[model samples]
Target: MARTVRDANPDSRTARARLEPRGKPYFRNLEPGLHLGYRKAAKGAGKWVARHCTGEQAYEVETLATADDFSDPDGLAILSFRQAQERARERMVQRAHAAAGKTSPLTVRDALETYLDFLDANRKSGLDARHRAGAFIYPPLGEIEKLTTAKLDKWLTGLAKAPPRIRSKAGAEQRYRVIADDHELFRQQ
Candidate 1:
């Protein structure tokens, strides 16, 4: 068990900062940003305490009634270390994104909804956006994660190459290999 001591600055570039655990009551498998030890409660016997912090200033902790290392508040044992690490990592990512004025782990639905929600009936281009979203966006790339540009491009290209919705129509659907919607071609002019 190694114990380190240091203070963290909240507004610092936390992802690039070191994750050395600073201070106290260290126990088995201790690592930076994770500390588990025993503490005496005011009214009862001593209990185990788990502390985890990202490179940011705030520390989040969990208390255990007994000496059990992996028990949750429900008294059943759970994998605490891995879960805490993941949580810390996610928090760091989210914080960085927030600081940069961007959203993190953007779901496919969220990005789509943003444009759809922002479409104003007053603007001339707003209806075009809504049209693009409905007629071109949803059918192919339905509920995928919007985390990466590569993913969006790949999805769009794949959708463009996929078989058409309506196999054949009254009009010249034969010229187009990947029509977004074949029904659009058949509309009575």
Candidate 2:
């Protein structure tokens, strides 16, 4: 078997202590721009947060596995420093690709979709209304690299003139909703 260099074990209390504010949060350099962080969220149940440098910025991502989960009932370590170190190394590599890009490309449609999902989850009854309110940002200025004042003006014009997507009446009698696209919305912001 191939021997490996080990970082602090995730299951060790000593390792967890080292991640606190007083102690050094980062340990053994698995590679440049990539390292482990002991993230304590609530009391002794926090997980590891991996900090990776990418696109001229550092991004911290949670590994989602708690140190307490691996420890024995009495809080004694379940694995040796060497064994836990090996496991942490493996997990770090697996998470690199997903968390590497801090400045990834994002479009207008993506933002709208995310917002729609949020509305559906948080404000269940308002999801449809929210979708209608946002449908105006399509057409000539459908997508852009972040919104500028000029793009927003164009969006306002489009909203006022764009025909409604749905005008049919259903069992409940669909009524027209006034999308909050008034110019005052911009002036106040």
Candidate 3:
């Protein structure tokens, strides 16, 4: 495994200014196949770039943002060393997903929101399902891909153990203790 080393040469404006401008960019290896680069221009501000190895002999390059050389970093147009590194990682991940013919991975919240939108568009009466998912499932689940069968089983068990809340005509709330005989109700839920 190749370890990432810290270098101050490409990190600061003054340090970068001391180096002679050239066609090649100064690179910092983030990992075995990933590199963050600072392409210093002959005049004006330098730009941040990211390089990712796609194959044994193939590499892909992307320009990320402007380096914090002449002005303070705005995080959008200009970036500091750390910020540039983060942006490079994000860009590489996006590229990797695209190369694999996949969209960006969706979080649990995103999936739920999408489903709710679908329900609304179809004019389906899914208000209860939406409420239950938002209040219970949304709080517990994170990324859908990270969830395992065991975790889902545990969550279902917890849901079954909790008392059911009932509302009265007077707009009052009541909690009824969960009973073993009420398995049918939980199963339906």
Q: All candidates' TM-scores?
A: 0.35, 0.33, 0.58
Q: By TM-score, who's the top model here?
A: 3
Q: How much is the lDDT of residue 186 in candidate 2?
A: 47
lDDT scores in order: 0.51, 0.55, 0.81
Over 1-189, each residue of candidate 2 has an lDDT whose tens digit, in order, gives 999965655446656665544333444444676666555444555554455555467555545344553454331333343444555566566655346542445667666666777878888756675546444454455477587889888778866776455565455544554546678974664
Kindly indicate the candidate among 1 and 3 with the higher TM-score. Answer: 3
lDDT tens digits by residue: candidate 1, 1-189? 898865332112231123334334333334566655444234323344566564677766665334223234333332233443344445555655776677746656667777666667345677777766765677666566644688778877987776656444546444434433557674631
- Provide the lDDT at 189 for model 2: 41
RMSD (CA, Å), each prediction: 12.1, 17.5, 11.0
- Quote the positional error of residue 96 for candidate 1 in Å: 15
lDDT tens digits by residue: candidate 3, 1-189: 999975637988888888677767788998778899888899999989888998887988888999999999999999999999999888877877788666868677776777888887886757877877855788778557566789889989998877775543444544565455577876776
Residue 74's C-alpha lDDT in candidate 2? 31
Report how far off residue 172 is in candidate 1 (Å): 16
Cα error, residue 73 of model 3, in Å, equals 0.2
Model 3 scores a C-alpha lDDT of: 0.81
Model 1 lDDT, residue 33, Cα? 67
Ranked candidates, highest lDDT first: 3, 2, 1
On a 0 to 1 TM-score scale, where does candidate 3 land against the true structure? 0.58
